[model samples]
Target: MGGTDCGAYRAGLGVYAIGRLAGAEAAELFAHLRGCPPCRAELAELRRVAELLAHCVPAREGAGRGPRTGASRTGLSGACAYGSRGPGRSR
Candidate 1:
């Protein structure tokens, strides 16, 4: 599926990662990833991003108190820049 192009490979990265790619296409991409440094780096980056996204849980606040737990977005950084500005802030 046109994986020779960096953009095209990136477009299919999420699909491949989530196990939604068709068998033939998945196999092809797997082969491509092995010898492609850029693709391998991107796949690693996507995995990192996916793991970060999975931790996105809504916080529960109590009356006149702090959050119920330590679950937070602090220190998270990416294209969204979730927590890279400053302390207790995001940009």
Candidate 2:
């Protein structure tokens, strides 16, 4: 696995690509990217993934047809019929 330094640099690169960095910090991350090949590659992959997810179709309501429990019906049980934790508060 990559070390923490690599992880941090990768994250910084990701943030920089998404325009989340400020003036001096953005310049710093770009400078780091110039010297760090691994971080540059990881940031490219992250950007691709972000682009793909951005275009994904959203699931329709009532599309899921599992057994209807009280929690599932009212969405109060915080468990989607598809086995995902429902929205609202986290457990």
Candidate 3:
């Protein structure tokens, strides 16, 4: 929300932080980040969220150890289990 020009780049920041953005789009975002302080700040915050999300995932049972059970895997665990806390919110 820094500016109208930043909306597009901000939209992709989440994917970029998670290492999903690639090719021309990522290259463009990187270049924009160099000149856009607000985008850079948002990118840093998104990276933190990405890190927290990574740790919130539950480890797969029997991963390479044995057969998996019928238990469904939701992927979300720990911090994300209760849903997103959003910016500045806490448990």
Better of 1 and 3 by lDDT: 3
Point to the candidate with the largest TM-score. 3
Better of 1 and 2 by TM-score: 1
Best by lDDT: 3
Model 3 poorest 10 in a row by lDDT: 67-76
Candidate 3 local lDDT, 1-91, one digit each (tens): 3344897788899999999999999999998998888889989999999899779977786655753332224554545644478535766
Clashes of 1: 0
Clashes of each: 0, 1, 0
Cα-based TM-score, every candidate: 0.51, 0.50, 0.60
lDDT of 2: 0.67
User: What local distance difference test score does each model get?
Assistant: 0.68, 0.67, 0.79
Error of 1 at 59 (Å): 13
Q: Please report how far candidate 3 places residue 68 from its true position, in Å.
A: 21
lDDT of 1 by residue, 1-91 (tens): 2346666567888877656788887887888887789888888888788777658745456643644334324533353443446455754
Clashing pairs in 1: none
